[model samples]
Target: MDNSKLPINQIIARINDAAEMAREIISEANIFEAIIEGFNEAEGTNLKLTDITNLEAAQDWIDEFLEKYSDV
Candidate 1:
């Protein structure tokens, strides 16, 4: 597949366009809140993205859960 003469750049441009459209439709905070909702459901605990001090800490908190349940 890597050696194929496909228009990889064009394909990537299309993907970028879709991502840009999605960004216009939804804020990162909304995505983070959705992730927090999933985390709460999976862990059987209530959590809120707004409670996190910063994005970095929010990322770390998510990484911790992913690491703990990586096998699943």
Candidate 2:
């Protein structure tokens, strides 16, 4: 089970897959950031989007916001 013995192509592919996952995470962060910005604008509240370092925190804010603001 030694990854160092893997072929160069396999190593490159694994790196590429990791990069793709990083990109996906950034995309999700951007989407959440936009929502946070809109919420701040509409509510006049300065909820720091950048302060949220991960998706879970973003989701927590979204959940709380919905609970407090959603009528449906």
Candidate 1: minimum summed lDDT over ten consecutive residues — where? 1-10
Determine which window of 10 residues in candidate 2 has minimal summed lDDT. Answer: 49-58
Q: The CA-based lDDT of model 2 is what?
A: 0.82
* Per-prediction TM-score: 0.49, 0.70
How well does candidate 2 match the true structure in TM-score terms? 0.70
Best by TM-score: 2
Q: For model 1, what is the C-alpha lDDT against the true structure? A: 0.78
Regions of candidate 2 where Cα sits further than 4 Å from its true position:
53-60, 63-72
CA lDDT, every model vs. true structure: 0.78, 0.82
Clashes of each: 0, 0
Clashing pairs in 1: none
Q: How close is candidate 1 to the true structure, as a TM-score?
A: 0.49
